[model samples]
Each structure stands twice: as C-alpha cells, then as structure tokens.
Target: MSSESSQLHIFFLPMLAHGHMLPMLDMANLVASRGVMATIVTTPLNVPLVSRTTSTPTSTKINILTIKFPAAEVGLPEECEILDSDNSKDTMPLFIKAVGMLQEQLEQLLSAYNPDCLVADTFFTWATDSAAKFNIPRLVFHSTGFFCLCASTCVGLYEPHRKVSSDSEPFVIPSLPGEIKLTRMLLPDLPKTDAEAAYIAKIVKTVNETEERSYGVVVKSFYELEKDYADYYRKVFGRKAWHIGPLSLCNRNSIEEKLQRGKASSIAENYCLEWLDSKKPASVVYVCFGSLTKFSDSQLREIAWGLEVSGQQFIWVVKKHENNAGEKEEWLPDGFEKRIEGRGLIIRGWAPQVLILDHEAVGGFVTHCGWNSTLEGVSAGVSLVTWPVAYEQIYTEKLVTDVLQIGVSVGVKKCDGLLGGSIKREAIEKAVNMIMVAGEAEEMRSRAKTFAKMAKEAVKEGGSSYSDLSALIQELSVRRLHH
Candidate 1:
C-alpha cells in the first residue's frame, strides 16, 4: 500500500466456516493495516469466533457488524451458527438455506453502510445481486489456489474424467496450462442419491450464475506459486481474478496471532515451542489433517502405528471429540503414549500450526492438502507427506507431489466420502521416511525452501501480491470517487 490513506471502505462477508472465515479476516486485517476502512459482516454467534482469532493489534480500525443468524426460520438451534466436517453433510442444506435467508438483512446493512466494495465468500451467491442493487463492486473470495480453480473449471467444461472406465484411471483435465491428471475418485464424490444430486445441481447453477455476474475473484494465493494456472484462468478460462495471498502471512509477526488464527489453541504456546526446541534441527515430522476431516478409530489407530513405526519425532494434532463413551482410548494402542513418551507429542485439539511449521526442528509435514495448510507448509518450507482426504485436496496433492515435486504422496488413491479412508501403517511410515529422513528428503526440502522464499517475497512491497492488492484498492477507490 502507498503512503496515502485509501479512500475506500470494504465490507467483508465470509461463510460460517473456519476455513473460509479465517482467510477473510486475514484479508481484512491486511487491508485495514494499509489504511483502508474494513468491516466484517457476520452472524451473532460467529462474532466471538471472529473476535478471538483477530485479536492482533492494528493501527487502522476494523469493525464487526453482525446480522442475527435465522436459526428459527432455518429450523436450526440458535447456537448452530457454524458448520463443520462432522455435521456438514446433514446440516449443509439447512446452513445454505439459512445463509440465503440472510440476503435481506445483508442488503439492509449494505444500504445503510454503503461501502465502496463488498468482498464475500463464494457461498454467498446472492452477493452479486446484492452488490448490484447498491451499485457496488463485489469481489468473490475463494479460499483455494489458482490451480484448483483452473482444474475445477476444466473439469466442469470438459468432463474428461467421465471418459475413463474406472475411478482409478488417470485422465488429464483438458485444456489446462499444465498436464493435470486426476482420477474420478479424487474429485468431490458425485451426488449419491437423487435429492443430493439435485441439491448439488442447484448450488452449481447459483455459483455459475453469480460468478459470471460478479466483478472478479480474490484468490488466497501468490502469482508465483501457480503462475501458469493464474494466467490460464484469466486468458483461457476468461475469469477476472487477482492473487493477493498466501493470506496467512499477515499474521506472521505475532505468535499469539498465529496460534489464535482460527480457533483457540488447545495446548500452551510455550510448551509446544519448548518441545520443538528440544529436537534436532529438521528432524521432527508434523502431522495434521485439516479441521474438517474426522477419522474413525480404526483409521486413527493406523496413523498412530505409522508414526510410532516411523521412529521419528512427531507432533500430531487430533480433533477434539466430546467423550460420551470413552472414544479416546479406542484409537490408541495399549501403552502407546508411554512407549513414545519422549519422542512424540499429541495435541487433542487445535495446535498453533504456523508456529510449529516455522520451527527449525520440523522438517516434514503430513497434510490432507487443504489449500490453506498447503500454502502454510510451502511458506514454512517443509517437505510434505501428502494424504489428500477430500475434494480439490487431491489436486493440491498432485501439485505438491507431481508438479512441484516438493512432496511425496502417502499413496491414498481414493476418497471414501469425506470422513476419509484409512491408509495402512506401511504407506504412512514409508511417506514419512521419504519426506523426513530418506534420500529424497534433502532435494524436497531444498525445493520447498525455494518456494518458501518466493512466497515471502510475493507478499512484501513491490511483489506480485502486494502490487495486485494495491491495484485493487486503487481501482475500488477510483470507483468510489466516481460514485
């Protein structure tokens, strides 16, 4: 941003989910730090969640404006403001319907505030129409990278995956800038039943309609990370978009901010850091599937066995489950914790992921390949053991393992419907060894470090993402002037 204060007021509307909300807050913080007035529009219940994560100090003010989530109208409990992986399948339709119902309240807010621009999550398809009614530009916010967007566009346009005889057959996503091959299983599963299929079709239709009508997309990626796909998306796919991220970098300065980026950390920051400090440099493997994924007890056991057998120092973050019937012990082998006492740390809830990844003791990551995690790991320069569990994650896995060659796959060939299928101990152990200790580890780490440098540079002054953000603000400011 330039020295001059921006004459712009931007309203941000993120979906009621962790992955979507965190990045949007990061973007808000970034813009506010650059002298642009920002307001986050969210539901009542989400306010606390947002406030907790965005506690970092900033010079310029950022406001939080809440619209009551219509739980009664949507047939949900009043406290059901956020959705997660475990309950998403059952609750998504109701969740989306409730989001749709917020259109009027949002329009009312827009009319009263009259912000220059509205940057909203892709889930709010009606934002296009809402922004148009107020004659303001609405920039759609996508949490994924350019590669995933381009791949999705190609898949939708060409449907090449349909030509394959089996789910495992690799078919190229036609007309992309690079050769991106994926099996049908790697994509989001086809709607299983007719009602589910109809719901998906409705969402697809709305998303397509809104995207065409919106101003452009705001992607959480740096141009250098996926330059070819970024170009292809604009030129060939003809979508207007800007890459203004690795958004997580905004919280790079403070350990408090990093640890509290999404939810409150279950473990203390100093304890985690001190544990990392005890290890040898580049010797510990960090294993975390994203927030949304929940593995069965059997699957969890496999991971435990794999990490134990790998004989490597590791920190594993497990999703917190309310123990109605003692589920924790079901997943662990007898005396497992005692056996790995000195070498392993298991966090039962949120861990400060960025802080851990940035540590010198951490050399490798075992990730589910969600875009945020992928970019964070890349920025931290850690080689990965890719274990893609859900939609578009496999694409990211391919980017890391195939295109970028900075990671190795855990040989997970299929997605067994979101909660995730189990990978055997042997495959997990092998991938951990390959990325952390084996012959390929050095080369992978070097490549990852190169990308890490590029990521940091891209977010600094005069860099690609910085320039794009500046241009976006200038454009929006000019439009405000005209109005």
Candidate 2:
C-alpha cells in the first residue's frame, strides 16, 4: 500500500459460518496490516468469535460491526446465527433468505459509511449490485482456491457431470486446467426439497448476475500452487482477478502464538500441546474434518479402528454429539480411546486447528480438504491424506492429490449414503501410511514443504501475492481518488 494516498477504508462482509468468517477476517487483518482500515460486518454470535482472534492485544486496524441475525423472524432457534448450526441442514433455505433480507440494512450501511471497497462473501451475491450502485468495487472473496472454483464453475456451465453414466464411473471435464478426473459419486447433489430448490435457485440467479459485475473474484491461493487454473480463472472471469492467498500465511506469528498458548483451542491446551511436545518430530498425524463434517457411529468405529490399526501417533478431533450422557467415548468405538490412549488423543470438540497444524510434531494431516484446512496444511508444510466428505471438496481433493502431488486420497467419496457405508479400515490405513511412513511419503513431504515455502514467500515483500495485494490497493486507491 502506498503511503502517499489516503487510507483504504474497506468494508468486509463474510458468511456467518466459521470457515467463511475466519478467512475473510484474516484477509481483513492482512489488509489492515498493510494500512487499510477494515470494518468487518457480521452477526452477534460471530462477533465474540472474531473478538477472540482480533482482541489479541495488538494495534489492529480492524473494526467490528454487527447487524441483527433474523433468528425469530426466520423461524430459527434463538442464538442461531452461523450457517453451520445444528438446524442449518433443515433451516438452510430460511437461513439463506434471512441473510438476503439483510441486504437493505447492508445497503444502508454502505450508504452511510461509504467504503472505498466492499470485500464480500460469495453467499452475499447482492453486495456486488450494491457496490455498483455505490460506485465502489466489490471484490468477490471466495474462501477456496482457484482450482476447485474454476472446475466447479466450468462443470456448472457445461453440465458435463450429467454425461457420466453412473456415480462410480470416472469422467473428465475438458475445461479444467489439468488432467483431472472425477466420479459422479464424488460430486454432491443440491437441495433435495422443492422449497429448498427454489431458495438455491435464487442464490444461483443472484450470484450469476453479480459475478459478471464484480470487480474481481478473489481466491485464497497463491500463483505457483495453481498457475494453470489461475490463468484459466482469469480467462473465465474476464476481469482483473487476483490470487493473493493461502491467507493463513498472513498471520504466522499470531496463529503460532495462539496454538502455543492453546488459548482458543477446542481441547484442553495444556494437555494437547504437551502431548504434541512428547511426540517425535514430524511424527503425529493430526486428524480433523473441519466443522461441517458429521460422522456416523459406524463410520466413527471404522475411523477409530483405522487409527489404531495404522500404528501411527495421531490426534483426532471428534465431533461431539448432541446427547452424550454417560461414557466419554460414547460416539466412538467402546474401547477406542483406552486402546490408543498413549499413541493418540481424541479431542471431541473444536481443536485449535491452526495451532495443531503449526506444531513441529504434526507430519501428516487427515483432512476433509476443506479450503481453510487445505490452505493451512499447505502453509504448515505437512503432507495430507485428503479425505473429502462434502461440497466441492472432491475437486479440492483432486487439486491436492492429483495436481499438486502433496496429498494422497483416502477414498471417502461422500459423507452421506449408508452413513459413510463403512470406510474400510484398510483404505484408511493405506492412505495414512502413505503420507505418514510409506515409500511415497518422502515425495509428498517434499512437495508439501515446497508448497509451504511458496506460501511463505507469497506473503512476504516482493512476492507474487504481495504484489497482487499491492496492485489491489493501488487499483482501489485510484478509484478512491477518482471518487
């Protein structure tokens, strides 16, 4: 950012989900670090979450602003604002509609604050139109990488997915940048209900309408990671798009400190970090399936047995069930924890993921390939056993395993259908061993480390991502000057 110009007061609007919110907030802080005044627009529940990160006693230039979450009006339960709420699966249509209902309030805020730029979540597609009306640039902040988004958008346009005969059969979409193959089973279906279908239709309509008008589509990926897809995305987007990401790289120190202090970690930090400390260097496999993944009891048993059978030191973050009265490992195999007591620790809630990934002992990640975790895993330089469970993550799994060669797939086609339908312990054992201790492990680890270096360099001065952000700031500064 050029100091000769006035400060860039940018307004950031993130999706209410933690995955979406966390990255956009991180982008906000990144810009704020570069002398931009960031105003993050979020709801009440997310406010506390944001404060926990932003309140880390520094002269952060970010400000938090709130709008009422339409819980009562939308027939949602009280205190439910995030998109990943327990009832979100049921109430998703209402939730999307309710978020759209905030458009007027958002427009009003835009009119009042008059930000130079509006960096908005993909869910809030209406923000682009609002930015157009306000004569400000609305950068579409995609929380994922270029490869997955490009592939999905191309698939949506061509509907090549329909050409595939069966879910199990492999098919190729020519529009994707690399030699990527996908099975129909790997892709997820949209809303099943007619009412939900209508709501999703509106979201699609609005997003398509606004994407043509958005200033740029922002991906949280670096150029070297996805050069071909980055070029393809620019050609498809037909705008001055940027790839200033692996956003986790922007706050290396703060995240390291948080993981070190175990302050905001989901488990008992003292126990968790101490356990990691006890492990050999680059030895433990940290397993988490992000926030949205839910495993069935059968699946849990397979996973527990798989980890035990793999004979590797591991830390697994298990999702807590709504009702847990007696046994601590009720959702897991009956004697699961006791059997792997010394080798693995299962934290049945949110773990300080960023901390765990950054730990020196963490050599392998059993991830669902959620975009945030992917970027974080890359930044941390850990080989990944890609276990995609939902969404367009299958494409991301391809991005890592096939394209980047930094990950190996665990053959988790879908989290649904027969309750994960028994993820054979052998498949899990093979993938874990591949990344953790097999012959291919060195190649994967080398690539992971290489990508990690790229991620670190991308955020530093004079790097590709650094130049892109500078270009964005300069482009916006000119816009502000003209205004």
Candidate 3:
C-alpha cells in the first residue's frame, strides 16, 4: 500500500467506564495494527486507566489525546486526579455533558494532526455535530452488543408508555427493522418522570439525527451472532452498519505484558490465575460483576452461601468498599471461607479478569452479563451463569440465557408476583452444582467451548469479524478519498 493508501487517521471517544473504555482501546489498537493512525480522546481521569491497559510507548504510532473536562468543579472530582475511585456514579451525567464542551479542543487537535475520520462512542453524540461543523466524516461506535443497543432504542421508542401503576402490564416494544423482540423488562432504565422522559427523548432524537448525518455505525459484534438484527439496522436506518468484534482478539498476546507494566494494584495479584491453574478442566466457575454495579448486603451474603452450598471451586471478585468495611471477615457465614479456603478464592477488588477467564481451569462464569464481560467470557469459551444487576444488563442477561442459549439464568423471576428475591445460599449452591457436576454442566461446557472457538475463528483472516473490519476500513478509506 502507498503512503496515501495506508495513511488512515481516526479519533476514538469513549464513555468513562472500564467496560466502555477497554473495548474502545482494543478497537483503536486494531485500527493502528492496520497501519492507521488512531487518536483516543479521553477525560483526564480516564487517561491512566487507558494507559494502564494499552501501555503505548512514546515511539508507538498511535496518538492519545487526554482532554480536560470543562467546569471541572461542577462535579466529577476525578477530572483532576489520575486514579479516582471506580465506584463514582454521580459524575456520569456531568461527564456525558462535558463531551460537548470538548469540541473546540478536539477541532484544534484535529487541525494540528489532520486525520481522515472520527470514530466516536455512541454517548458522544455531540461529536457528530462537531465533525459536521468541521466537514469531518464521523462514525458512531457502539461499544456494547447489537442486542443491548436495540434494547436502549426500545426504551427510547417506548418512553411515553412507561408509567408506575399498580395494574400496569409489561409494555411490548414494536419491532424495529433490525431489532430482536424486546419487552419493557429487557430494556434499560428509562427516565421515569415526564421531564426526564423528555430529556431522554431529546438525546435519542439527537443520536438518530447524528447517525443519519454520519458515515456509518461500527458495532462490537459479529454477523453470525446477530445477523438478523444487523441486517435490520442497515435496512431500516438506511445507514451502513458493520460488525467487527470480540475486539479482545488483539489483547490475547499482550495481556501479560500490559499487566506487568500496569499501575493498578489489582493487576499485580496473579492469585486468581494461579488458582484457576490448579482446578480441573471446566471444573471452576469465575464470578465477577463489572466496576459500577452494586448489590445489597443481603444479596451478597446469599451469593456467598450459594457458592458454599454448590460445593464448586469458584473465584469471586467482591468490592471491599461496597461491603461493610468494619465487618469484613465477620460478614461471611461461620467457617465459610475456611470450608472453601483451598477450593474458593475471594478477590477483594478488581481481578485480572481476562487472564483469569482464559486460564485452563475456568469452565464457567457467574457474571452480571455486562457487554464487555459477556464478550470476554464468550471469547474465553466459558459458560455463563447470568445475574443481571442494572441498566442494559437485563438485556445482556436475556441475550446470554434466552437468545444465545450459551448459558443459564439464575434468580429469574416469573409472573408469580412472588419477587424471586435474592439468590439464597441453597439456590446458589444448586445452580452452581448443576453447572459444575451435572450432565447439564457438560452440555453448557460444550456449547461454551464451541462459542469460544467461533469467537477465535471470527478474528482470523477471512472470518466474519475480520471481513467486517476490513469492510469498515475500506468504507472509511473510500469516504476519506471522496470527501
């Protein structure tokens, strides 16, 4: 390829969560691997997190632009610091709004570097307007799965009907061109009040309008996984949609290297991986929820008991701060840790999740079904025990348990109005036991292994994800030349 042909420049703007940033970074790395110059625009607070994950050297071709958030004092204390506590939720709205204010800085950076196109996160809808103002072609990158995006769209479309009433029935969302059948139960949390609903409506409208004006949509999913929905997006929206994912493919080789140089304390403890090494093939379950989701004390205790009852070798990541700090060891049931000491490992903070999942001993995952976690689990060929906590997670749980049939759902509530409540020790024990020791466990293991193989194949040359990525680059390259 000539210098002109190979010289592709793209900017990546990601939301400020670990789940969102990690995949975006992986995509940016993929672009760079293809000889494209990629610039990742992130908040000052997230720069360290990205740096820790990528460990991009000064000599590396890719550029990382860490822009300061405006009205720094308005909220979001992390705006000033490099490593803020991961549990911060109050800053979400403010951080989202701040993306709009970074337009001037982004434009200045763009003019200096002169890139070919902008590839931004879905949350950065404002980037579309910025790109248009500067005559730069833009692409919206949905970091999550296609199903989750569709569920969010459903919430937007059905906003008017969401009312809290005693006799209210579940609202059925009309079929979107490329979307799967979804109910209100599977959707993300929508704005409840009329005022909040109007705000969300405005945001969704802006997303649709901006998407129409952009070059295309790039999703972190593959054609085989959601072919029907992918087709629906292209047909109904009249906008090009490409699936180029399981982005973690590129990280397989460098995960260890990245961890060695990563600044996060949690990354240093290789105990989880070491524990997995001791278990038999497909005998251990790995349980972790993404950074933001929280459970009540009762729920946490129930899960502990469940694991105890299941009598399975498991690795669980529990946040120290989320639990009662004072009663840390005392919180568990009598001799719980002792009974399962050698069999189970309880990681207090963030574990080296990808490394743990890829370990040979890990056969199943007890996950909150966050998109990134789901993709990681799938890529690792680990079956899931779905326990969705919030937001689009419910949709993710449905995808894993219902649509994909790759995993089983736990704590699922039926129409009995009994509120299935939290997973008790016995229920957890039973679920884990079935997945680990029963015939169903083997079936799920086989299915998970197959999916993992498919994920591997998808990233190889000529595979669906590989082809989609090639097509995305070609489309962007063509748009660059024509414009």
Q: Whole-model lDDT, candidate 1?
A: 0.88
Give per-residue CA lDDT, model 2, range 1-483, as digits (tens): 545246779999989887888778778878887888889998887777777655554436578888888888988887878865245467777888788888888888899988999999988878888888888889988878888878887777776767878767888876777768877667755566999868866766677678778888778889998988888887865655888887766556765445522125666777888999999889999988877676777778788888889999999987756455664655577767788888999886678888888889999999888899998999999999988776777888999998999989888765452123357888998899999999999888999999999899998899899999899888888878888
lDDT for each residue of candidate 3 in 315-411, tens digit (9 for 90 to 100)? 8887656556555554467777889889888877777777778888888888877788898899888788887766667777767776777788786
What does the lDDT come to for candidate 2?
0.80
Which candidate leads the pack in TM-score?
1
Top lDDT prediction, candidate number: 1
Arrange candidates by TM-score, descending: 1, 2, 3
Better candidate number, 2 or 3, judged by lDDT: 2
Q: Which stretches of candidate 3 lie over 4 Å from their true place?
A: 1-6, 56-60, 78-86, 158-173, 176-186, 254-270, 322-331, 412-422
Q: What TM-score against the true fold does each predicted structure earn?
A: 0.96, 0.93, 0.88
Model 1 per-residue lDDT tens digits across residues 1-483: 444344578999999988889899999989988878889999887888788766686425679999989978878877888887556668777988898989999999999998999999998999999999999899999979988888877787788977999988989888886687788877876677999978877878789789978999999999988898899888886888889999999888877778768877898889999999999999999999887888888899999999999999999988857567745578888889999998999998787899999999999999999999999999999999999887778788878988889999998878775577879999999999999879979999999999999999999999999999999988888887888
Q: Distance from true position, residue 169, model 1, in Å? A: 2.1
Give each model's whole-structure lDDT. 0.88, 0.80, 0.71
Pairs that collide in candidate 1 are none
For model 1, state the Cα shift of residue 342 in Å: 1.2
**C-alpha lDDT (0 to 100) for residue 456 of candidate 1:** 96
